[model samples]
Target: MDSIDLEVLKTAAAWLNAGHRCELVTVIKTWGSSPRPPGAMLAIREGGEIVGSVSGGCIEDDLIASVARDGVSQTAPFLLDYGISADQARRFGLPCGGTIQLAIEPLSGASGLPELLARLGRGETVERRIDLKTGAVTLRGASADSTLHVDGDTLATVHGPRWRLFIIGAGQLSRFLAQVASAMDYRVTVCDPREEYRMGWDLPGVELVHCMPDDLVLEAQLDARSAVVALTHDPKLDDLALMEALKSDAFYVGAIGSRANNAKRRERLKLFDVTEAQLARLHGPVGIYIGSKTPAEIAISILAELTAVKNAVPAELLVPHATAAPMSVAGCVIP
Candidate 1:
């Protein structure tokens, strides 16, 4: 599955390749409560067909109508602001006092979108800079921490998978997690040394390796933008991976197990000289308490918690509505 930004870039490239004029609109800045954050994009064909969104439907409608009537006449990029006034905010369905500034760039050969797509295809994070005075663009290697920046004369946006997920098992639940994480634009790798499990893995765009999980964790050199999840129930596999991951800078390190199992895992890690602070970083009983029973639902719940951590949301806000213990069969959760 393609991310929304990827879809926009691909659609814009397709339109340009088919001899159609299109404009790329990206949110550069926002004030107050806006519907979309900075870096949200929209691709508008000359005929007003659009592939992405920058705001609620009302703002899109206006852009489409303007492009359909005017035929993308601009030769250079320009700034367009919306919802600057109370009446305009009402008209655009923006929150009161909300304002969004967009960089509307006319697509052309100078935009370098095809090259951007190619670099992203190679699994490299990229920083794309566009000159506002002209449509010329430059693409260069970027770190995972790169972000969107807009100066007076240039608009820079980070593209590609800036985050990565390292899964320590290639089982059924791992398959679901890999698929969902890929759609969320995470570069995912599932490591399993067992041949029986490795041979059956067939997901596209996800890397599968036949190696020990702990070795892969060390080789990855996980950063703050990375995550580690141990889905295998084996103590040998999950325990070693957890030990290395907990000591790394990975923002979220989790393992799948019941509450009692989680406690046991912590105790075992303690014996390995893992510090209390480092062990505290582990998120066992992995996901938020969503009462999920199936593998797919469990994947959603796990990603929900990961998203919460990524966004710096307080854990107190995610307390389950019911305080009852989760249901399990024979000391194993259904997930």
Candidate 2:
């Protein structure tokens, strides 16, 4: 699953290529408790068709109304606002007097959206600058080697598919995790040297590899934005890959095992000269303590933890509701 912004851009490109008149709306600023953040986008097609969102339904209704009345004849970009007043906030269902500012621009040849999509498809980040006054747009290529400039004020940068995941075992759990991760726009790879595990694997959008798990980890050149998860219980398969992963810049490195097994695994890693500092980075009892049981529920817990780390959200903020008790099965608390 691509991000909502990328999806919006792709949808807009499709509509534009089909000769349908459409306008792109981007949220440039927000106040109070707006539903969407800056850079949030929505594409409003002719005849009130829409893709993506800028608010909680009310603002979309307003945009649809505008499209029905004005069509896409306007060339100049327009700044639109909603929920500026208490009454307006209540009318739009924005809690506690929230407000959002949007820049509406008509797409054309000069926008270079199709070219931008092409570059993004190649795993490159690009910056799109829109003139608030004239609706003119400029596209610039960006990478680790490129510098970004926005007048005297450097605008926020947008990225394409940069997140990656390397799964150690190609089991049933790996299949579920791979599908969920792909929907989150991660380029996923499953590595398993055992023929038993590799023979029946049949998931789309995931790369299946028969190379040694540890070698595959090194080949991927795990970076700060990448993640590694070991699903196999075998120490020979999981330990080598995890040892290399802990040495890399991967932000999240985890393994699936019971609490006692996790402790035993850590003890085993001590023999390999791994320091306590590096060992601390491992999330052995992987996932938040959600008390999940089934493989599907366990997958959700793991994804939730990964997303929390990615977004830098505090764990305290994610405490379960007071009314819900922890889930347990067969004397094992699955978290």
Candidate 3:
């Protein structure tokens, strides 16, 4: 599923290219239990067709009503506010004290949206800056660390997939993981030196490569936004990669195996001069342990764990806490 914000941009671009008028609405500010965060976008066409969301359904409903009544004009972008008072909040279906500030602007050639989409397609992280008074837009290459910034009548939002996943296998499990991760806006690359296993691999938004896992890991320059998951289960392939990945700054490093195999893998890594701290960073028997028994289910569990880590969830709240009963994903019965 395309995230609502990205889908909004793509739909607006399509409408613009098709010679239809469309307006882009972004949530630039919020307070007191807002329905969406800053930088959330919604696109509305001249004909009242809409995509994406800035609030719960009620907010979108109000936006559509505005378009239908006022029509999306070619004037400069302006800010709008909702739920400013108790009566207004009740009418807009917002929480008692919630408020949302929006930046709504018409899309056109000067918006640089097509170019922005092109850069995103090339896997480049981009920053789109909009001048609130002039309705002008500019696109620039951004560092992986850049985030959305709104200040002083200007809005700068990051676009494109900012996260990367390096999967050290092209097996069935890797396919599901890759597909789901891609949907979550991760640029995934699958590496496997085994030609037999690499055959018939076909998935969009994922790169397939015939390379040793260790070499790929070293070359990846895995930063905090990156992740490494080894699903090959082959010691020669997975161990070297894990050793490199765990020592790097990647936010998550994991390998799939049973509890016994994971324990053995840790013991074996110690001979390679892998330090205690680095070894502790390894997530073995990888996933949140939600009783996954199939490849698809396993993919879900891994994503859940990865998400928890990404969101900085506390240890006590993370699924299958370190002190809880251990479960193996290697065909173990839940009982």
RMSD, one per candidate, in order: 2.2, 4.0, 2.2
Per-residue lDDT over 238-296 for candidate 1, one digit per residue giving the tens place of the 0 to 100 score: 99999999999999999888777788899999998999999988887888777777788
Clashing pairs in 2: 1-183
* Cα lDDT of model 2 by residue, 1-335, tens digit: 46677788899899988988898888878899999877778999999999999988998998899889888755777677888899999998888999888878888766678888888776567777766566666777654423323343223335465588899998878888888887676778999999998997887657899999999989989887799999888999999899999989988989877666778888988888777998988886777757667777767777887888788887577642111244452245433
For residues 58-104, what per-residue lDDT tens digits would candidate 3 score against the true structure? Answer: 88998899889998878998889998998888888788688988888
Decide which is better by lDDT, 2 or 3. Answer: 3
lDDT of each: 0.88, 0.78, 0.86
Candidate with top lDDT is: 1
Candidate 2 runs further than 4 Å off = 133-136, 144-157, 195-208, 219-221, 317-335
Q: Residue 279's C-alpha lDDT in candidate 3?
A: 90
Per-residue error for 166 in candidate 3, Å, reads 1.2
Q: Ten residues in a row with the worst lDDT in model 3? A: 320-329
Clash totals for all candidate models: 0, 1, 0
Point out where model 3 deviates above 4 Å. 1-3, 321-335
